[model samples]
Target: MTFTTRFAPSPTGPLHLGHAYSALLAYDMARAANGVFHLRIDDIDQSRARPEWEAQIFDDLSWLGLSWPSPVLRQSDRVPRYRDALKTLWDQGLLYPCSCSRADIRAAASAPQEGAPLHGPDGLVYPGTCRPASPPSGPMPDAVMRLDMARALARLTHPLCFHETGAGPDGTTGEIHPLDMLQTVGDVVLARRDMGASYHLSVVIDDADQAITHVIRGRDLFDATQIHVLLQRLLNQPTPAYHHHRLIRDDTGKRLAKRDDARAIATYRAEGCTQADIRMKIGL
Candidate 1:
């Protein structure tokens, strides 16, 4: 397969130093191997996405010396596709509608039950609030849809693994066992009521549809990879080789956010910083 990867970002705010690092790095790697690099607009949450921010994403990346294939894939235009995948999972007894409110989850997670922290990140087994004992019967519901983690894992007959060119946060490399997933990441939201598809589901579908051979992103998303791998198996999609790189942080050692306007690529450009300066700032 060709060396294919992508840099997907939401147009919710300015592209910060972290975004620069990721996009530039992906672009560089793609060029190095004579591979393909794609720019995908991760506007799954349309509520916060803006045209100005999307425009700036193009401007900032171009200023940083990067170009991508035209007619970029935008999540807003792909809800129907996401819904199709959701329906497939729903029919396979792998998805169920979720109706638990934030308050309900917080209340349950705060008070430990069944010797498992249902809502706790590290101990997240599942809340099972809206998860039916058996897959609900009917056309797919118009509510939040969550994957049944255990059921999804059960469907995977083979041992799951991914090529880890970059290390995970805890230095985890490959060969993720089923227990690890069951112990940590629980029944995650695959399709949200408002967004139509959650990050995990949309990303899995997008990567597959794009024929992405490798997934390169920050280590913060390492844990989420487990969810993706499981979904890939359930959906019969190929799991791309993953490289979870280190994050770009501010002087305070906190991961850069869009709110950090001082670290925004546009701010640096306005201050007369060159593309190399941006690369150097992000330690490319």
Candidate 2:
């Protein structure tokens, strides 16, 4: 099979060292394997996504010596696709409307007898406050849609796993188990009340739609891969091989954020930093 990878970044902020490292790594891997590398703009969060930031992403990646095909995939343009995926899950009795707010979820997860709340890739684990016995008559505008993990898992006859060429956050490699996923990632949201799709839902759908074969990205998303695999299985989509690279951290050892303007690629370029300098800084 042709090796296919992607560097998907949200336009909520400018490209930082971390973003550079990931994009370059994915590009290098694709080239090494004589594969295709794609660039996807994850601008689903319309409230935070800015056109200027999106343009900067193109400039930064091009400056780093990268090129992708025309008509790049953008999440904002794929809402209808996500809706179709949600409809499939709903029809299969795998999804339900979640009416609880963040505060409501936090309180429920923290309630007594729940022990310490299980934290997953999407922040505090959902307490399943809104999972229903059956699908609703129709989509509710005000309700976030969540996957019923237990029911979804039960639908699968065989065990779920993914091939990992790179290490996880804990330095784990090889096949990953879905057991930990069940314990940690509880009832993840597929579609938000405001936004049509959540990161987990859109990412899996996008990867499948793009026919992505190898998912090379930061190790920060290693845990989230569990959720992605589950979604892929539930949707009957093909799973791709994964390579989770180490993250680039700041001098203080914290993961770089978009707000860290000092570390932004544009800022570095303005300061007379060369493309080689970026590669060396990111240890390419």
Best by lDDT: 2
Clashes of 1: 0
* TM-score of structure candidate 1: 0.96
Per-residue lDDT tens digits of candidate 2, residues 1-284?
Answer: 89999999999988999999999999999999999999999999999999999999999999999999779999999999998988888888888877788899889999998989988898898887887776666654446888888888888787878999999989987555656666788888889866899999999999999999999988999988988988898889999999999999988899999999999999999999999999999999
Give the TM-score comparing model 2 with the true structure, all chains together: 0.96
Q: For residues 1-284, could you state the per-residue lDDT of candidate 1 as single tens digits?
A: 78999999999999999999888889889999999999999998989999999999999998888888989999999999999999999999988887888777666656655454543232344567777788778898899888888888888789988888999888989678887676577788888889999998899999999999989999888878877888898889998999899999877889988899988999999999999888888888
Q: Which residues of candidate 1, in runs, are more than 4 Å off?
A: 112-125
TM per candidate comes to 0.96, 0.96
